[model samples]
Target: MSPMLDPRRLTPRPIPHLPEISKRFDGVVNCSDDTNIEGWKKLLRDDRPMKLAAGSISVVEIESKVLTTGFLEFDFVVEGTGDAPEIQILCAESYENDMDKGQPRSKDDRTNFRTGKLYGPTDTYFCNTKLSRNHYEPFWWRTFRYLRISVSCPPTSSLIFNSITYRSTHYPLPITTSVSSTDLVDKLHSTSVNTLLNCMHETHEDCPYYEQSQFAMDTRSQLLFSYTISHSDLLARKTIHEFYASRRDDGLLETHFPNPGRGMNIPQFSLYWIFMLQDHMIHFHDLALVKRYIGTADGILDHFAGRLNEKGLVGKFEVEGTWAFVDWVGEWFTPVKGFSSMGVPKAYYEKGAATVNSLVYALALKSAAEMCTALGRNDTTTEYLERAESIIQAVNEHCYDVKNGIYLDGPGATGQYSQHVQIFAVLADAVNGEAARTLMRRTIRERETLGLAKASFAMSFYLFRAAVKAGIYEEVWEELLSPWKKMLDQNLTTWAESESMVRSDCHGWSATPMYEIMREIVGVKSGWNETKIIPRVDLVNEMRGSFVVAGGDTVDVSWGESKQVKLKASKDMEVELVLRATSIHIKLLQGEEQCFSWT
Candidate 1:
């Protein structure tokens, strides 16, 4: 008899661009209007189109010389003598249509069909003045070029656009995974895909089927990539605030209710989403979002308050008796009584009662403090701060093992073993010198011990900040930038989902690691608080420069052997220079020369 078929090695269907040249799968442009009116849906309303922001992207087969995608890192340039050029590139390719009807071909069948440019970011501004006339990247599916450029306008509005240019990089377009039901290589993964770029601008409480929740919480967790792509914010305030705006009076805040976890029934990511939203606010200080969700933001606090146990803690809401996102053991954030899938041990979660709840509460409280303070709620601000303090104290009492100088939760001879707890503890600033030091040591030594429940980005940030605190700022750069290095290496551009050490998703929140690397690895601190200057040129040896997100005032700090280190800022203002060691001291005021220990 012939060898039987082995149902293992199944790769998900890859999105096809040209003739049979599929690489690895990435993302897509979703334009489905099936659930437009649903509370949370990706498609725009029937009356008009939804606000699709990403460039209409497709993975077209291209040889090395042909132009492809994006507007950055390309050899060509936009043309504009006196004004910016209006440029738009269209990416179209044949997609594999899995759904088939009225024929012998089943829905599982894969066949190629053509697709064209969908939509891109609204109110796009351009300022290219070099390649306006010859802005085309020819492809195998090369279509006709269309243009209606009119430069002479009302001076301020249309006159600004005079060129169109595209960015070409080593990053290749995604090829869909070709996995079928019969063949299974890895652990079970869901197989319902919509588009690579799934977005929902608005949702209402009355709408049926929490489709927005569906898109976000799907098994793929791919939507989380919105934060990692070009022009992305892995975690955005608007995403969470609008989600909150659609909450019902009963405070149920949407649910997968009947189906539970079968599909992306977001019975309640409200808590998680709100926490993420507040995180962005603190990092970016986007007051527009604060003002938009001021009232709803308070409403979220009320939810936390009402849900707290008699001791002001939440239960592991996802699964009972299980530790949630944070921990409640060792020198930890004192796990609040809440349900979380963020930071629980996979084994510990078998019976539910894993106790890594402390981290979530600490972050939630800190977020609360930030949101409250930003919203001008003085009373709430104080309450949240006190709550955060109390939680820290409680975590110390329960999760911390003072003798061992570590804290963790869960039921076991050794309890929960994690490093993310340490990261969150540092991020929350809830621990002390010795514990922080130990926690930092564990993270530097062991990377993935406790991040099972949390996202990899959480660990990345933890590593970055802990490195800064431990005065290994350069190490932090390597830790934080490692993920991006992998992404850039694999593809010229990053995608929503990844195939790295952790294959979840690429997100704006993940990209924040870049910001952390710039601020912490280089040891740059700002604000009315204490000032810090620890120059780190060591890590730059690994990669080129990176940008700082809406960072504070300009800074100048570095140490080099027989070299003049120049630090420039936006404006030359009064400054303070403090060195970590007297061995290299610099005292410069108002752009004056500061003496350094040049080795």
Candidate 2:
């Protein structure tokens, strides 16, 4: 469980230098004016609408003033056709222990689940309201979604308006999106659609794109999105290659880049490139792109392999502390020692989250396995798989915290749910029957665990399946809809940058997984792997999809009209279908795959 943070408790941690970073990077981007700050204060502070649409009372436009996590506050703009509408706002705040570097919980502990109010932008905002209200304010307008502006009126009240009005100090609107049928978004929604989609584009001169020293990480609370998107891969690849060129006498890339243009040194995290490369493969299954990162993957695998001690577990380079693990946010760890803290002592090695080490072990060995497969090197493939299995065994044996039946956050030292631990365990596909069931139970039963409901949006996909495997399909389904419904209530279709859990921005790397859940498993995996499908049509699941896209160089289509589903992966790929009402043949070939899972 999460630890309690009181005025008395003290934990030395890295202070997010966003304000300082802001001032340092000023001129290129100017800070909001005092008036803008006042606007922000009013919006977040008193629930007042600083700017409203001329014809409406509830619909108002707002913008982010402070640059902390990349989210600027936005005002709710409801489009009332004719009459005044009632309004209500729901907000969230990070738990107190969230600010600390060393994890506050041991692997065996549960999330604190306790919430603290955000201390608002101004000192007075913090004071004006109850502590709970204070915690609800944005720290620096980090990205967020599931934002809702509820408007209610009598059936007779017909107040029509064109659109809601907002005051944007920076850009005119925040991220937004068009609503989809499957998603239940209904209230006033996001102002920007790109908030969650921009992470894959987080490149600067030294980022995946520019690799420059002058570019700032910009947002302090922004989470990591490792997948490449659209044209983003081209420059990201260039920056990564060059950064690796000088930095890699050894083969791995850092999981992150720091100091503007510099690459990260975390040996294990550098492996994110492998996962990213795999995602790129899934996108187009492009052999050329797969070949490009093949060498880089092998090098990283080898570098990490070099660090394994006699016991074979990779060390905690991503997080180093007094037995501390990845800081609560899951970034930057001391590379000092493998399991033991460098210069600290052999005993210190006993501390740290076994889950994180499990992640390194998994990432390292899996990357090696995938690289070997891409290279068609059998022996290397066998070697990496064996290594991965070893970690899996160790994880099963030591990391389970078996008596509790739930995976521990990490080593016993600093244990708490930060989302990464729970997510890493789930994604690794390492859990067995009962253990998987336990995890599924915990995912819904516990909301604050590892920020599962807040920060890790993609993590739910795995948890949902795990939950289904555990037999609570309905609850898992609700888990899926809860936030999305919150978004729907706000009239949104795409992923939100941040929900109550993350209470930040929707992420590109994170959001892409939603499609996987939508089409691949529930809907269908149509293209290469060339998933050949026998579509099921009863809607045993709550799927509302009509078409699924599959294939590459040659596309196969899977679609549903009434009850039947079909798949075709060849030139003008085709599928035989039977539903409650329609029977048809679909011709598909765009060198892509589609979904139509209905039997």
Candidate 3:
């Protein structure tokens, strides 16, 4: 029988950030005085219309006097009523680095430039005198660091703006975590924080610039980072509840939450939903709150469990309309021999389970077992653990090529391989120690030859985790610099959806490096009673940072010298300090501190 728990005791505590205030556009881009108004109008005409550009393509520039967050609404008051006038405003949180800039009529590329700007531009607001109100305001709040406003009226009529206001709105949450380093890690951290803040609203958005949808894969990364940096679970909890609310008839959770208009399904995404709850449990320890969704988790596992074949693998899900998507790149499908572009392997896409999917299933099952154990559901835990072990053994037997020291995409050990399969193997504990180390090294070196699926920002979270877990700290550190710095080089204030040309430039998933910095570099892993600190000191020569773990307790760590590490706890907390091959455990009473050194 499940243990009885009080729901009230599981309510998450508040973490506060300063409230956002309204800020007006710094100044008009092309038109400051009446003389320049015509020029601005002309530029607007040259620019694509709102329906053509997902965002405004060309217009007069308007900057905020100071950069601010939480852009909510825009208000414009037109003085002069000779004839009904129309105006268009383009908004962008990062205008100068915007991908839509200067590409007014670019053909639709599906992601950013999809036909019909239903989502509008990164920031596009339109107002016409149809409503007969002198003041115009949009229905919803927008995000932007800049705006481009254009006014159009009857040739003989005069239009003047008496007042203009841009209101910003967001769940006010303070930036509690801090990171200071001698390298550009701090810049990456700050930018990642900005991305997270932008994507965070009523729910966690994949990217505020584009879809503004809360995706499972994206939310998983944002949720982990939010706990470490924001030190709050309010948004995370809201997101969890939202996803649970999207449960489908077949026991699969929808790919995204607040389902805009139509319902959609992704088989792999449902797996992520399970993992998400596990993460929530680890960070918040609110079993009572999590108990509300045990049915959702069980339903998902039951559905998948029924489909396992003789080899303990879930083959192609024959459910109609089900999208078996694993990641953005098509390489998620088993790659064709001697072919660079990834396509569905007819053998597996129709009859066999993709190794990537199998590993995810095992990991999800493992996570379920942990959640069950926490809730005192020993029976469910045993069932899930057994199923997870079976899948793991099957994966190693079918997917791993002992001769090549690599993992294939599917059964029969296809010559084709991807970094994805191996990464998840480590994460699921299906591979460990020397086996994990060798696979990671080969993944990096044989990347080109194997057509190893390149990880976009979203998958990079697992890729980094697997790399760190393999005890290859230096490589993980070195690998992080390029992808992020490229975004910076492109003048992006936030990480892009992928390095793709026609994708949303600001994506929350790309912010994995921030979580890595706090979790792996500082090495803070929170538990119900004890927090673990296993610093990857080799990654950086000298570093200092602080993060709040599960119980709303702040922990700080710094090491300047080669072999010394210092830690301070804000409250009484038990911590385990792990070195390369050894661990030093300590218990600190209230307001206590400790330092350790090793050679």
Candidate 4:
């Protein structure tokens, strides 16, 4: 294996724009309270909308030739004799359809002369002509396919732009991977990858347009997605360093890092930091990097070790006023009748031992144990494993409903359940095989099942993983596509934070489709010494793909027509071809290829 590079030295790889596109003014008209171009067309200049004043306001619609590119920063040179025409540039991903809502869409598509032109970070900005620069760019990059440059200048001022173009930027990693499947599957995969590219900035942002926070839960999916598509671990390593940098005096990690102020504390987010570390080691297998962070992992474990309840489950936050958020579940966050106003139910969140929290803690402990064992810290491993087992026993006895055959949300929860605890149960191996299958079928699989709400975008990753463990790939794919297609129907260019009228249009957590296609559908999982090739032929009749995996090996896999499957690797590599939960081990010299049929 090649020696690992220092991840700290990684820099942003700028993706320069192709030869500039010459865009022409489609028309000069008034667009007010309009959500679609057709809606704007219905309103003429004669209507004299409140915001679109007669001479003071004019919407300059710029249309570019059909050029396919990911949305990034737009550079515009606004040259005007008077007051540098205040401009609001709106970018869109699809111009052919109403999906190009001219600008970012909000629930309230109203026209207000005061703030109507403002939307998120892409709002109106006045160019500084005296600063020795004629061009204007925002603090962050904006995503778009079409640009709606709204220049509102005074009646006496004439405004014209010399050069208006866009420059795309990302981690600049090469796309050393390919996925081939059905047409719809291909589109889904592209959308997922696009979401990841947009979400990744200086640090892994949850979304570029909104919040712009580097959230651990959100970036975890993006990290895994990058490994499959980009085949680089630099960003993942950088993210781990950032999370460790955000560690508090008490050793807890922040929900979002590099905060302007002290970071917001979420007890569960700190636990996810541990999971992220383990996940990175699993994919990259850089022992030096893993060893460097083992102490940080120990610090995190130490923080939680002091908070375990008598029953050995993490109870309430010993650190006062800390948010013990598990997921955005109504049961966890939304107060029941008769509780205090403006706060979540204490029993569900702060007070009792939550099944989700304890299970995740147990999983984290087990993960830490594995990492410790890998690092030759057997004492730490034994300690973590034993503690994890105690918590698991406590969870099964206290949280699991013996009669209902499912886990409760918390020890105090009675009829109150969710897909989260059960999913985590399978992930932690607290439940497996028949028990897990039964739990998922009863709690998660059935559409008519009503007790628990579905997972939010952040938690859906685990939902997918647990479903796979339970051998529910069919249901997993179906469940995965529903929300994604819904977003597509709404013409969302980037993944949404939730399936609602939320402010953030783009989020990294929702970029699950691409990672699943590569990992689950194509089944290319990486390890330090070898890569595991396990394509799920059951999901699709014909599936074929190639990806550069861990240790710099290019793997090509195809399963079709007959049960026979073809596989190949570009380097001397060891591979585990997993089928029906059984692993078939194989090895190859450099540039070797082989084909095998599944029985």
RMSD of each: 19.3, 15.5, 7.5, 7.7
The alpha-carbon lDDT assigned to residue 552 of candidate 2 equals 26
What C-alpha lDDT do the candidate models reach, one value each?
0.38, 0.39, 0.69, 0.68
> Residues 434-551, candidate 2, lDDT per residue (tens digit)?
6666676675667564343223344444445445455455545645546555543433323443332333323332343343333333434443344433333332333332333333
lDDT per residue as tens, model 3, 357-459:
8888889988989899999999999998998899999988887878777877788746767778888999999999998887887776678886787666788
Clashes of each: 85, 116, 14, 1
Q: Which 10 residues in a row give candidate 3 its minimum summed lDDT?
A: 47-56
Candidate 4 local lDDT, 35-90, one digit each (tens): 43442332222222223332466564433332223333333343344565577876
Q: After superposition, how far is residue 374 of candidate 4 from its true place, in Å?
A: 0.8
Flag regions of model 3 displaced more than 4 Å. Answer: 1-20, 26-59, 64-81, 92-133, 162-165, 260-262, 330-351, 561-564, 579-582, 587-599
* Model 4 misplaced regions, further than 4 Å: 1-56, 61-84, 90-122, 125-134, 143-147, 318-321, 334-346, 349-351, 562-564, 578-593, 597-599
lDDT digits (tens) for residues 548-591 of candidate 1: 22233334444444333444344344334433442233333544
User: Which one wins by TM-score: 1 or 4?
Assistant: 4
Which model is ahead, 3 or 4, in terms of TM-score? Answer: 3
For model 4, state the Cα shift of residue 513 in Å. Answer: 1.7
